[model samples]
Target: MLPLESRRDMKIYTFENRTIDIRAYSSAGGLFTALAEIVLNKGGVVYGASFDEDWSVVHRRIDNVADICHLRGSKYVFTDINGCFSQVCADLKDGRTVLFSGTPCQIAAVRKKFGYHENILLVEVVCHGAPKKEYWSLYLDELLKNQGKTQDEIASINFRDKTKGWKNYSVCVEFKGGSRFIQNHRDNLYIQAFVHDYTLREGCTKCPFKNPNSKADISMGDFWGIEALAPNIDNNLGTTIAIADTAKGESILDSIACRTYFSVEQVAQYNPAIVKSPSVPLDKPEFDTTVKAEGFHYAAAKFLKPVFDSRDRKMSFRNQLRSFIYRVYSFIKNR
Candidate 1:
């Protein structure tokens, strides 16, 4: 079975130097505004991934809260950053108050690269896991192929549309063909396969970053129960469940003055499942045999063959087919 498929409840915790609750908040805008406010107050730049002209990933700095809008609806898995952890470590060593946001794995990579720093505030999103980058590339390639357009023909892409509800998020692709394709989530088969864990990184299946004891100061996730608890808050607009994992997180939240926010209980009614589920152990092996080259391809092929075809194909036809279907569906639905 896939790792995430386990019906086990994920554990989330709040820590403080002394306080019990550690102070929680709700409201997506309030959460972002709070984080942005703290960064600006410290004269520190908020460094996170943002979309560039090519629709690829790049790290960007935001000096003002208004710039936070650029990061809204960013996919939890894929980040728009160049280089790897080494580059990120170089930036952190410069001693800037930086807010790094990404999936738990990427955040863990950054922490592994730079170690823990008081000035660095790591904010991790609650992620299931990221799909393979190759899958994404192939999916986009197929999309352009189906649309009769080249990479140069694409103007831009937006994965999530705020105007629409989260379940119906659409992928807006503007083609050089001067045509636009706003594919709905349901029409995309690639997305379905991905959600079903057909294209996740092998490491992700046994991820090391699923730790509630994470080094992040603050962790954020969609407030699944926003409507039921904070009925006053705009549930359709989305809300973030901000948990303070450190004193720095509390300090940051205390400094911001914005829209109304609430405690964890305020939104607990919306998601009893996650609230009651036990946290999984974060310990994981160094590598998974399925995706690693050193592992037996025949054994891996045996498990994946049923999904596609288990022939002695060089590229592994079964795996590739599974990947292709997942990529196409994910690009359309999850984006």
Candidate 2:
């Protein structure tokens, strides 16, 4: 179950940005850019996730926009948070205004590590969950092999490419020679598995931070149902939903270049992840076991076999409770 403090009390907004060169992973409405602008305006360093050479996501810090331009989009994999918290603490101790952006749990960990620092601004993304690193690493290898490309030839990868518009977004990958490969999410087997809730990390299935009230100053995510609620808003590119959880968050939001504040209910109605955890698929354990015994491709084939099968459906309350108990027991046993 989610923590009660994270249940309600938030201010929503629609944000957009057309100036920067849009990347594959960047969501519509320039939400991250808006947050980066705040750090820049305050002469602060921005801490965000960046992809490593092997396509793994790692936390990084940047002081200039040009250097941090690639930190725009989603990576969809478990991020390496090593050194990020310590760096933020060191910077804040030196009196720097640090904007640390990541998933809700990452922000929560940082908050717990530093306790309430006035100089630190925590911004969490509305997350579906971090997919397993091993699965993603294997999936990328398959893509590279299918394309006949070497790892060194790859320049960048974007999970939220908007070439086909926001709603039908595709994954975009660029090689060093400027050649690009774009795959619609629907056509990608790995993405299909991810969206179906098969490869997600265990912690995400029972997220404690999946609530509106946040320890961070602000929370942001894709404003999914923008077209239905605000007909005037241009969602062709994409729209961002920013929720202010603190006075400082609200104050910083008012200064963003292009944003319009709206009621909290507008966000809750569209994105259920705001109030409750996403349902875990029934075949999750089998999916994990198959991935370990066979390969990602084989496991994906098994996962795609049928949609109506009972084992593929969401877990029941009894199962969820049992899983939680097992997780707690395992944690204690490991300790």
lDDT of 1 by residue, 1-57 (tens): 012222223223321111111111112333554565567677666766666665555
Error of 1 at 131 (Å): 1.1
Each prediction's whole-model lDDT (CA): 0.54, 0.77
Model 1 residue 78 lDDT score:
63
Task: Kindly provide the TM-score of model 1 when superposed on the true structure, using C-alpha atoms.
Answer: 0.62
Best by TM-score: 2
Using all chains and alpha carbons, the TM-scores for the candidates as numbered come to 0.62, 0.84
Q: What is the lDDT of residue 214 in candidate 2?
A: 65
Task: Tell me how many clashing residue pairs each candidate has.
Answer: 13, 3
After superposing candidate 1 on the true structure, give the runs of residues whose Cα lies further than 4 Å from its correct spot: 1-42, 52-54, 58-70, 76-94, 176-178, 257-335
Question: For residues 1-335, what per-residue lDDT tens digits would candidate 2 score against the true structure?
Answer: 12224334445776776564542346756778867876877788999888876778788999887766757887888787867877887898889988888889899888888766788888888887778788888988877887899889999888877877888988888999899889888766678788778888888878898765467787888888777777787547777788777777767776773455566667668777776666678878888898788878788877876742454344465688899999999999999
* Reference-based lDDT, residue 214, model 1: 50
How much is the lDDT of residue 2 in candidate 2?
20
